[model samples]
Target: MIEELQDVPAGVVGTRVSGRVTADDFRDFKPAMDRMLDAGEVRIIEVIGPDYEGFGPGGLLADVKQGFSTLTHMRAFKRTAVVTDKEWIGHTLHALAWMIPGEVALFGMDELDAAKQWAAG
Candidate 1:
C-alpha cells in the first residue's frame, strides 16, 4: 500500500510505501507524481517503511518504466530523497547517483524528517 505523506515541507512531495508492493500500488500514487511533474522542478521524498514486504507481480517492471520516464526528464527533479533502511536500495541509488541528473540521496527510515528537510531545500 502507498499513502501520501501530508506532513512534509511545502513544495516537497512525500509518499510512504508498505506491505507487498504491486504495479497497482503505483496507480494509486501516480497522480501525485503527475502533479509534481506538471509543477516543473521538484523536491521529492519516498519512504519505504518497515512494513514493506518488497515488490510483487509486475511491480519491479512498473518501477523500471516509471524510473526511466523520470530519468528522461531528470532536470525536473531538483532533489530526490529516498528514505529506506534497506541496504540494497541505498547501495543501488548510490551506484546510480552519477547517472542521475540533480541530486539523488538515500536516507534511513529513521531519518525521514531529515530527508524532508533536505528535499525541501
Candidate 2:
C-alpha cells in the first residue's frame, strides 16, 4: 500500500510504500504526480519501508515505462530522494544517482527527517 507523506512543502511531494506494490500503486500515484507536475511542483521524495516486498512484474514494467514515457516531465524535477532503512536499497540509489539527470540521494529511515530536509531544500 502507499500513502502521501503529508506536511511537506508545496513544491515537494512525498510518499511511503510497503508490501508488494502492484500496478495499482502506479495508477493510484500517477494522478497525484500528474497534478503536482501540472501545478509546477516537480520535486519528489519517497520513503520506502523495508516491508516493501518488491513490485509485481507488471508494476515494475509500468514503472520503467513511466520513466521513459514521462522522461521530460520526470526530468523537470530537480531532485528525488529515496529514504529507506535497507542497505541494499541505499546502495542501489547510490549506483543510479549519477545516471539520473537530477540529484538522487538515499538515507536510512533513522535519518528520514534529515532526508526530507535535504530533499525539500
Q: Best candidate, TM-score-wise?
A: 2
Query: Which tens-of-lDDT digit does each residue in 1-121 have in candidate 2?
Result: 6778887766888999998877788888888878777865477788899899888757888778767766767557787888888888877877777767567877778887777778778
For each candidate, the alpha-carbon lDDT, in order, equals 0.85, 0.79
Q: After superposition, how far is residue 48 of candidate 2 from its true place, in Å?
A: 0.9
Worst 10 residues of 2 by lDDT: 66-75
Query: Residue-pair clashes per candidate, as listed?
Result: 0, 0
Q: Estimate, for each residue in 56-77, the C-alpha lDDT of model 1 and write its tens digit.
A: 8888988887787776567788
Candidate 2 local distance difference test against the native: 0.79
The residue ranges of model 1 lying beyond 4 angstroms of the native Cα positions read: none
- Clash pairs detected, candidate 1: none
In TM-score terms, candidate 2 sits at: 0.89
TM-score for all models, in order of appearance: 0.88, 0.89
